[model samples]
Target: MITKSDSTTIKSYLEDSSNLHGGHADKVLIPENTAELSSILIECTSKKMPVTISGGGTTTTGSRIPFGGIVVSTEKLNRIISIDKRALSCVVEAGATVDDLQSACGKEGLFYTSHPTEKNAFLGGTIATNASGARSYRYGPTRKAVKRLKMVLATGEIFELRRGEKLFTGRGVSFGLPGGRRIEVALPSYDMPNVKNAAGYFVKDDMDLIDLFIGQEGTLSVITEAELGLELKPPEIRSCFAFFKDEENSWAFAEDLKGKKEWKILSVEYFSENALKLLRRKNPNVPPASRGAIFFEEEGEEGQRYSAADRWLKFIKTRGGSVDDTWVAMNEKDAENFTSFRYAIPEAVNEIVKASGFRKFSTDIAVPGGNFLEMMRFYKDLFRDDGIRNVVFGHIGENHVHANALPVQGAELRRAESICLEFVKKGVSLGGTVSAEHGIGKIKHMYLKEMYGDKGISEMVMVKKALDPGAILGLDNIFPKELLQ
Candidate 1:
């Protein structure tokens, strides 16, 4: 294991994309492979030292920032074990970046559906949070794509789990540790949110054992390697940008577009007036007379692609859009530009927050379709009433919208925090998830109880103790610090 203990080196691993808070650590470890990583974990656990797993340094929830003890970065174990075209799957080290995996798979005529804005993110981090991106509207989250995983316990025991290989029998799960000891973990009796939730441990009456580790936010074990399922590259991908009169109208059109079952929509992304304003600063190609925009992509046969494109053009025009104002990316280069246009929104927001010297107060709330419009309206009114600058965007197709508040002053930051809590409560009350894609790290751990009631939390805590008797892995993440007491 390569370890760094100097103050300068330790500080480099303290912050992430969240910019909400920074962490301090005594040492940092970058292990080359699972064996080296396990040896380090064994020593740390023996001393009851906290271990924070860092993956690509792109986490907005502080999961990558070490609170204390030590930080372990998985940037070195980035290797593609294999890409079996016949099975339509790829095996990779957890540290391999999203872009690396996608590009490698692309060479084999395959596709990786969960392409989040940050292509440099580690696959292990995505699996840790069970990340879902724009294309997830059609492909689902990382949980759906993962076929198998190899994990190492804090005590240096290694275990490999394959999807559907083990099923919960309602009693619990049993496994043999490396040192002649056996560990059996009981399932949490909590009911998970029906929507795209990445809040806490995945639980059900009879769940797959592999699922228990997929979205646990690194609390259960350290994911070392994974085998991910892939899809054949689409024969054709048609992209279009449709600008609407306002935020409400854009989502209204989104509802209608998704309702059309034959569209074969690959992704339906939303951008509010504020988000568009941010993007326009960097790229002037935004359509005129637009308060909001919806960027959508569809995949189908040549005939089907033409048919879908025609239907989209007609729908946008009938909804007050013009054919000339719309932008089409029929080729490869144009398609890449459209992607930059969407990702630019977040990049701009981060820049603004950094310059203003304030913490980011972004809420990752998602409600069911029945309550999506109401939730959007609620968010807009809350920000407006409080006089806070905000931007709304994300996967509106699944009713999951991220309302990001950019506050400059300290008082404004406090109000932004309060509003975030208010909106999260409202989202939960209306059958929504407190977190749609971002997992509850140290910053949002308190909201876990609201997501799952007292009984449910107790069940979850019991499972946590069973798996991590020492609570050394991802200490103080997902669950509040008081839970440790």
Candidate 2:
């Protein structure tokens, strides 16, 4: 019962995201509930119209909007249905923002540890990408946090999937037709890696069936609601920002810090010279002597343990690492300010790219701790030689780095992409992942084969076909469609 005006309004709304890519849908639908969502999908499937589901529209991968057909938005379905305090879990509608859930959990002295950068990103979107952040090194990613999900299949059937159940059968793959008729098909399952994967279908024989929906990016099914695990907040929290003169010193310091069994480091983030310059420009009040900064968080008995900021300075002094400045967040207000500085890089880069009329792309890669420094040295020289001005930063604790390429358009952009692909190939050869935290959306689809060999990718395609025979959901998102075509 979507009117023409309603479609127009929905289309307009979908276009109002931070999406730089300009792929648009012909029609849009806003479903108020799961029933309404199912109905919309039924009609779309009958018409063979492509369908894409969106949450916060913060996806950089062009996963939120398709080239044509209908776009279903779960924005209005946002709600925290219930919190099972005894089980330490919360049930929430798909569109509920991370901040919204965090606020609700804070009321009961609990916390959901999955910390994605965007506060406004929806819970379902986080699940779709298996999103993680600096805290992931300690708390793990969204897959570990999600316990259950209520998802809608391609055939407009609703299925409730739990952590320990099977995923290839039941209501998940079969939909009741008109006059009590039933249609059945096998649901494909991929061999999901046990590590932090946010690329494509996660498949594994002994894996939790619930994980299939955790990072599918709404291709196989649309997640309507989910139950996520929670934990009590740490008793005491403190953060330290340390500045280092060179990458070698920073790596040595991080290794030394890891060796220290006394302190529990929640996150150890690394920033390159370019990233430090951007931070200094954004916050003129902060000194610009820092070539790199590491944010360390710890918890312990008050007054008994050395503060993270104090330890950071001590470590730098002991190692003769030139220390430009240090900042300590002992209180909530200070912590908020420090996090703001860290998160501002993405926004700042986007704005600069827009102003310069150039396209920007981020290359997120993860290498082994032993090879991280070497890889950085290689890429730094590579980009420099290629004349690609960029910024490099990421969660060092997890051995992931976000090498952001600056504004490049048309031929230049294509050239940069080639360079990036070469870099990714090199990373895989060196025992690293092409994608660290960011899922392999349209941007990185070409490199999917390089990361996962032919056998691995063939298994992924088989799963996609089994779950979505029509290929209606987010087509050509993670893996290139030409291969399937």
Candidate 3:
């Protein structure tokens, strides 16, 4: 184990991409093995000291930021335990980053389908939040990819759980562990949205016991290792950027693309006029008349690549898209460039928020397919009238779009927060989730309450307390720390 008590050395662990302030920690502890990690937790629990588990530090939710605790980072525990090529699965430690896993799996002609776009993100952190990314349109979220998880409770109890091994019995689950100890938790009764979600605890009728900890945001237990399923890598991927004159054309293109199952679409992403404005800063290739754009990817055999490109060109023309303005990447190098373009939106938004000196406020809301157009219109109406600079982009195939409000002044920042809350309420009313991929960390506690009422929150807290009696893990994640009392 390694420990750093100096404030200067511990400063980097105090913040995440959320840019939340006032975070402080007494020490930073790096444990190399599960036993070392358990011993540290045991001592912290005895002292009633809060312990915040740190991963890649890439989360925008501020989940890893410690308010007052000894930060326990998983960096040194990094390891790829095993890879079963025949079973299409791999087991990795909590500190193994997605980039490392992808490279390892790629050598075996396998792919980590549910990996988030951020390459530096740790596998355990992604599992803790049930993260989903661009390819999630074809392959589901991290919850689906996870086959097993090894977790350590706040009491220093370690246990391994596999999917379908234990199930809920009428909204209750009981887990028997080592040393003759057992933990029972009551599931939250709230019905999760049918759309994409990573909001709060994943709860369902007769849900798998392993799911209880998957999206708990480290509030229940520390995820130590994960056994994840993989997919066969596609032979050829077709990436395209179709520029439209307006939002309606782009929306129609996305909807049409989603309905086509034979197209083998891997992702359907959207970008607004404002988002394109930011991209123009990096790449001046954006057409002036293009107010909106849809970037999509499809996979097929090498022989079918040429035919697929022809079909896509015809479809784009029919959807009011300009072939002259469109950009297509036929090779791997160009495809990666297209991906970087997609990621540039959020990076640009973060830069604006940082320069403005205000905390980031962005919507991760996802609505049902039928209600998506209404939700999109609602966003446009509010954004147009609000007078605050903003940009919209995200996974349109799942009807989950991110609207980032860029406030340069104090008053604008206050109004931006209010407008974001409105987005949350509207999403919930439309039978959507307050958060789709980004889990409710310290920042979105109130939004979680809006989605799940007071009773829903209380039930979730009960589950957390059952696993973490000391209430020392992830103190402010998903809900306020005071609620645990």
Candidate 4:
């Protein structure tokens, strides 16, 4: 493990995708294996040093940012231990990136559930936040796909856990940590949202203990390895981009497609007019008459693929979109291009945020499926009269659309912050989640408290205290800085 205080390396390691926030670190360590990881943790614990466990730095939240202590990176621990094609599962070291795992699955004609092929995102980080992408509408998030996980706690307690290996006793599951100490985290009293969520802590009645670790954001333990369940690749996957002259109609069309049982719809993504403009800036040849776009993919057998495409064509035309305007991708290269086009919207927005020299204040809130239209109407009505240059796009199938407010001036940036918080308040009021994919990392800690209130926060704190008695893991993460001390 490298422990030198190289400013250049420490600076690079302390920043994540949430370029808006960063922290100070005196040192950095890249552990190559769990033994090394445990030893490092033990040393840090003895000295009472705050240790930040950084998997991949692609975190949109500031969870990876170290406040005062050394940062422990999982970069060197990347190794695909084994792939059981027959069982459709793969065991990987915590440092293995999402791209690496997906490529390995592709070689074997298998698939991992999470489609977030961001090269920098590690398998451990994905599990840390229970991250989900567009395909989550059909395949759920990382938590649902996880089979088993291994972790090294703050006191150097090394343990491996599986989903069904333990049960609750009306108190909570307990574990014998590495340092010969027992850690018992009782189940929290609060229930998670019924919709998609990645908030502070995951708790439920008779919940599997694995659920707590899957989305614990390193506040519970530092993930060292994981067993991910895979599935057989589909015979044929067809993609389509349907553009609409009016943005509202695209939302309606998306809602209608949700009821189509004939086709195996994998995802339904939405792109707004301003989002389209951002895409054009990044790629000139987007499409003609494309004020708003609906990107959907259907996976099925060869015969069903074409039939799904035909149905989508007819539906788009009926919804005021021309058949010629729709882009269909049957080949692999075309499919890649279609996916890239969908990803371009966010890249373009990030560019806008960077050029403006302001920290991005993107909203990642979600409402219950039934309250989607209500929340959309709220956003449309509020932003329609306002002068904020915002673009809304994301996993529309789950009623989680990200509103990226591009505020150029300083005052506008502050206004964007308030606007995002207000949106979170409204979403939580509708029985939704303050965070959909991104967890309540350092930046969204306040929103987590706002959504859950004092009693809820206390319940989470109880769990935190149980797992990390020293409060040595992930300072300034989901819990408040004050809670750590």
Per-residue alpha-carbon lDDT of model 3 for 1-485, expressed as tens digits? Answer: 89999988988899888888888999999998899999999999899899999999988999999999789999987898888999999999999999999999989998899858788999989988899999999999999999999988899988899999999997998879886798888888999999998999998899899988887787888899999999898998889999999998999999999999888899999999999989999999899889999999998887565677678889989888867978888778888899999989888888887787778899999999999999999999999999789999999999999999888888787799999999999999999999999999999999999999999999888988898898899998999999988
- Residue 374 displacement in candidate 3 (angstroms): 0.5
For all predicted structures, in order, the TM-scores are: 0.96, 0.90, 0.99, 0.97
Better of 1 and 3 by lDDT: 3
Give the least accurate 10-residue stretch of model 2, judged by summed lDDT.
186-195
**Candidate lDDT values, in order:** 0.83, 0.73, 0.90, 0.83
Residue-level lDDT of model 4, residues 128-208, one tens digit each, is 989999999899999988989998888787898898886566548876655578767777677778999998788777677
Query: On residues 364-460, what C-alpha lDDT tens digit does candidate 1 reach at each position?
Result: 8888888888899899898889878888888888899889888878878778888988898899899888888988877886567778877766777
lDDT for residue 10 in candidate 4, whole number 0-100: 76
For all candidates, what are the clash counts? 0, 3, 0, 1
lDDT of 1: 0.83
Clashing pairs in 3: none
Candidate no. 4 TM-score:
0.97
Model 1 residue runs over 4 Å out of place are 178-180, 302-308
Least accurate 10 contiguous residues by lDDT in model 3? 301-310
After superposition on all CA atoms, what RMSD does each candidate show versus the true structure?
1.6, 3.5, 0.9, 1.6
